[model samples]
Target: MSREYKNVISQIFKYLAISLVFMVFGFFVGQRFIPQEYIYYANRIIAILGVLFVLLAIFSRKRIIPSRFSMNYVYLFTFIDGILMYPLFQYYLYDLGIGLFVSIVLGTAVLFGVLSMVSSRKSGGYYLGLGNILFAGLVGLLVLGLINIFFGGARFNLVISAISLLIFTGYILYDISLIKYSVENRFIKDKNDLSIHVLNLYLDFINILLNLLNIASYLDD
Candidate 1:
């Protein structure tokens, strides 16, 4: 990799590590520092903000996030998303204890590492071509997730989470491939591009991590 490309990748890894720390810190805040009801609402608030931040970051070129905005907010939303995920992780921890949490994190780390390495290679075009299929699967998963929210069936949730895990695994591979392609083609022109791409990888990582934790926790419960 070129030095610039290597620097970009290193920045991505650095941001991801920092984001994970924020998540763990959020967990501590939720479990100890804050009241349960407050943390409950805080999670919702952060989730909404997370979406808005992502959208704003995407549309920054149009003056939504603004050119003057710092990259800190991009990372902040990542931290917020981590906070938003705290409850789900806590629930799983309750279900399966600390061991499962550790295993899930380890497994996700390994999977992400392998996928990122492979996807960063010059031969990563195959994952890039799956854009349409991946979108279709995500939409289907969204519909199924909504249905489960209303119906509350164990079977439906299991299936949904399983499918979600697969989708996010695909996402990780595809997203990393996109990063490699964008960097090589000189498509990542500004901080906006960097922030958005990092956010994409962060989303892929968290989805797989959360879903893996959920699935294993359910089985263990």
Candidate 2:
């Protein structure tokens, strides 16, 4: 592997490891320590803060803030994202049961590992057309999800979960492959570029994990 590739790989793994820690913390807080009302309200606040951090990262990159603020934006968003994983996993643990939750986590980890390895072996990003198709599917999935929230049935949700699972799996492959291409092609402008890459991979993994868990829970029901 090239030095830059190794650097990015290390950064990705580092954040991933931090992700596990926050998820465990979230699980613990939700299961044991947090009271019902606080659990309800805290998530709302955290959700808003998460959005702000994302915006901060966006604006920082656009140079709305000083150049020195760049890494801070990335760091804050990354940390917040890790904390966000906790509440998410906690909710899943409660709804899905510990056994199923463990199964899904293991399954997601294996799937992500395989995808990352496969992506690393490739030379360039897949065609832009694939990304367009995947994104279109994602937008459709969101519309369906919003509709399902109101008017859909169990079967509809199951279908949505299945489709989301597949979409994110494709996303994982696309993202990892893109990471390789960008690095090899000298597209990484700075550390912030790697930060954004890690965030993308992190989101992809989390989405796939939740989608699989949702599918599993529906099947169990």
Candidate 3:
């Protein structure tokens, strides 16, 4: 990769690592004060913010404009996503059955790794197409998840969540790698683009971790 790409990747990872640290901290802190239902709402709000950040990133890149809108939105979204997902996971921890949860988590991780490798091989319109696919998948999974919560079995919900988590994680890694490669190739002219990459990765990490937490909670139960 080129130096610019390296710089973007570096920033993305840096922000991701920082967000993880804060997530852990917030998880502990939230345990003390927040209720479970409210936490779920908070998670949804963060999800919305994440969606918005991604939109800004895409728009800024297309319009040849740059803004800190990406970074701030991602940072806030990741933090809140983590905070809210924690309680939900805790709530379901005992019911998920440990053996099954472990299997699911491992499977999801492997799937993410594979998808990342595949996405890395293509570019240009491929990235845009992939992004659209990802967005659609997320929406579809979200609907299924909500349905499972109200009308389906716990096992069904867990399964859907695990798949969703893996896809989102793949997106996070893919987006980070793209940004890095773009910067290195001089494809991204604006520095703000770097911020967009960072935000995308951060959100990806948040979603992945939250899904993992939920899986863990299910296993514990």
Best by TM-score: 1
Which regions of candidate 3 are displaced past 4 Å? 35-73, 89-128, 184-191, 213-221
- List runs of model 2 lying over 4 Å from the truth: 1-3, 26-88, 127-129
Candidate 3: pairs in clash: 4-184, 5-180, 5-183, 5-184, 93-217, 93-221, 94-221, 95-221, 96-218
lDDT, residue 212, candidate 1 = 75
- Per residue, candidate 2 scores C-alpha lDDT tens digits across 45-148 of 33343334334433433456443324445445555554554555555567788998888889999999998887777767753346777777766776676666
lDDT of 1 by residue, 1-221 (tens): 56767777787778667766776776666566444555334323423433343344235323444433355765677666556556656666666779877888899999999988877765535478877777777666656655555564555666766787787788778877777777778777766566656666666777677667656755875
Residue pair clashes in candidate 1: none
Question: Which prediction has the highest lDDT against the true structure?
Answer: 1
Cand. 2 TM to true fold: 0.74
- Report the CA-based lDDT of candidate 3 relative to the real structure: 0.57
- State the lDDT at 13 in candidate 2: 77
**Of models 1 and 2, which has the larger TM-score?**
1
Candidate 1 similarity to native, TM-score:
0.80
Worst 10 residues of 3 by lDDT: 42-51
The C-alpha lDDT values of all candidates are 0.64, 0.64, 0.57
Q: List the residue pairs that clash in candidate 2.
A: none
All-Cα superposition RMSD per candidate: 4.5, 5.1, 5.6
Worst 10-residue stretch by lDDT in candidate 2?
42-51
